[model samples]
Target: MDFEEKPFLRECKDIIEGSFGAYLNLSQQIGDLVNQHAQMVREAVSKLYSLLILTGNHSKPDTGIFMQLLKPLSESIMAIQEFREKNRASSWFNHLSAISESIGALGWVTVSPTPAPFVKEMTDAATFYTNKVLVAYKEKDKTHIDWAKAWLQFLNDLQKYIRVHHTTGLTWNSRGTPATASAGAPSAGGPPPPPPPPPADLFADPMKSGPGGDDTRSALLKELNRGTEITKGLKKITADQQTHKNPALRSSGPAPYKAPSSTSQPVVKSVAPPKPPRFELEGKKWMIEYQSGKRDLTVSDTDMSQSVNIYKCKDCLVVIKGKVNSITVDSCTKLSLVFDDIVSVVEFVNCQNIQAQSMGAVPTVNIEKTDVVEVYLNAKSLTAEIVTAKSSSVNVSVPSANGDFVEHPIPEQFKSIFNGSVFKTEPADKAA
Candidate 1:
């Protein structure tokens, strides 16, 4: 019985070893395929950059050359996809995806008829994707990392070439002076050849041109119309291509990646997580709230000018400067708002213990469901609408009809909750 058990255990050991060996072989094959794919992508990017230079120099790209280069690129992209599908759970999936995207962007640029203007854009996009791949693998995969870096350098060189030699109008072949001119001047007695017939135009006005007479004006008009139509068609094509450029922008599921337009800036989408109410302002943080004790927020003119949106904040002293388009504060408690040189529309709702001052333009102020509101504005015009405030105090200085400053107190009826003096008006000159 002991001998029989020993034989069975040997057989089981052999089976397990064989299975492990097979898995190792498969992994080796996959690794080889990945390297091959990366090599193909590198080659494609190189060829594409060469072709772009040719195009920028006014030389037409050869279709045969493009087809030859594209074949390997397409193969690599496909192989990457198949591998990713087969090993969906592998940690390398993200890196592989990023590599594929970079290659796809290069491929798109390669086939584009007018890619010179987009060279920088495509190169930047490729760099972005390749960096993502490097980050995913970290210190692993040194070969591919080096390859990607080299490719990026090549792209940078190509971008510089395109920018320096870009041509604006239609490219014309150099017409060496006619052989006759080099040989000798035309014979004085020989009649000059008749001017070439005007080019045909589908929209030409026949009645406008008389026989045996030059119709230069009519021809110019026809050319202008044709140029306009061509421009419109080109614009439509550009718009359509932009729609497919960024996969992140598409409402549908992820698709093959393409480079963003070189002429346009990239759009960033932000999704911020909800935060607990607090008043803290430091550096670039938006939400301001007091955590333990009193705090001060001194916003410079440059900071105010750059802020596009201001949200809820409380329990701190806020000094605003410069101009903001609009500002909205809601549900804040024990807040002090000071305006140094603000030019903005401001709204406050359900806020308590508020103080506001305006030294520049008196922005349109809208208040609702607030208590203990105070404002001091030295402005040309003061416009404010308050829905409800328990206690409100206001001092405004406005220029009189004679350009002199005058102070006026806000009407008692303006404060609905309870108010002794809601507004105080002073002469603008005296306030200054």
Candidate 2:
């Protein structure tokens, strides 16, 4: 009996192996089918986006709803495509594949429908699929969620792009009212102003030599100077975090209060610090020197109580007069200079190769005559961030580059990063 069963057992084994082989082949086919559907969906979305742009020239009856749905739909589609590219076999994932199929089916359903219905269906499917995918992503199997997010961003950008192009007419004022004059107001009937005559030559330069000989160069320089002054007011916020630690200007703490004989509610305790003077983060080269006569003057390395100056003579580099200050530089070619807190004046002459550092607390970056290429100029107390340039047509909008008045302090977040304890820590395992 045992000998007779051997052949049957071998036959059974062959049957099982053949079944698994067939199953593997079918699984692969299903995966390919899913990928094909995803690709088709992406194409459909791109076409829809284009159609929207073309049609959006005229105001839609329901423009707000259309844009709202369109934006999210494109975003979801982009997220889907991105996920597909990153995940080699996303289509084979049982749950994910089903969601992708449903989404793709929705595209087909909306193909010939009117904008209103199509938008409704797209919005529903996009939201549903996006949620499903997000859940999967949170579980650390981000295959579905990644695709959904990409698709969502795509849809959003498409809608936003269309909305921006089609929007027109005067914008509302701060009070949320139309900016045009009130319709009920009385009209001021007057003759229209005469139109100005065209010049003899349309292409002729306005600054061409006239009775007053060409003063174009001087006028242009003056205009350029005016623009520089305006930019000086735009300050770059620093990396310092502490903006409220000044003790000099802070108000005194509240005195202990005794409860009246009559029943009274207890006063709430305040957890925040007392009001202090707002101090901005100064850049490396310049620091806020003490408030002088009325205006703030920057203290320089050479002007310190102890002066240190570096000079180059006949090809020989020399520290001609003063002591060397701190030099700090980054790979980006940004450098900072730090000198004796007391120095009032420093000069660089006929020298190119230089290291940089940060001065202790001088407040403003004072730059003397030198052919420096690219430098970022920042004054801590003043509200301005500037890039200095030397070449022609290069715009350098620092404080003195085109002296403009600035009063606002740099933002605290940026200042904190630059002056924080964490930033000062030495590289170690702690960095890890």
Every model's Cα RMSD, please? 29.9, 32.8
Q: Model 1 Cα displacement at 105 (Å)?
A: 50
Question: Which window of ten consecutive residues has the lowest lDDT sum in model 2?
Answer: 179-188
Q: lDDT per residue, candidate 1, 214-261, as tens digits? A: 456657777788965757655344654465685555766557688887
Give the per-residue lDDT digits (tens) of candidate 2, residues 329-426: 11111122334332222323222433222223223232222334222234432332222212111122234546663332211122223455465433
- In candidate 2 the C-alpha lDDT for residue 227 amounts to 70
| Candidate topping TM-score | 1
Give Cα distance to truth, residue 263, candidate 2, Å. 95
Q: Pick the candidate with the highest lDDT.
A: 1
lDDT, each prediction: 0.45, 0.33
Error of 2 at 178 (Å): 35
**What lDDT, from 0 to 1, does candidate 1 have?**
0.45
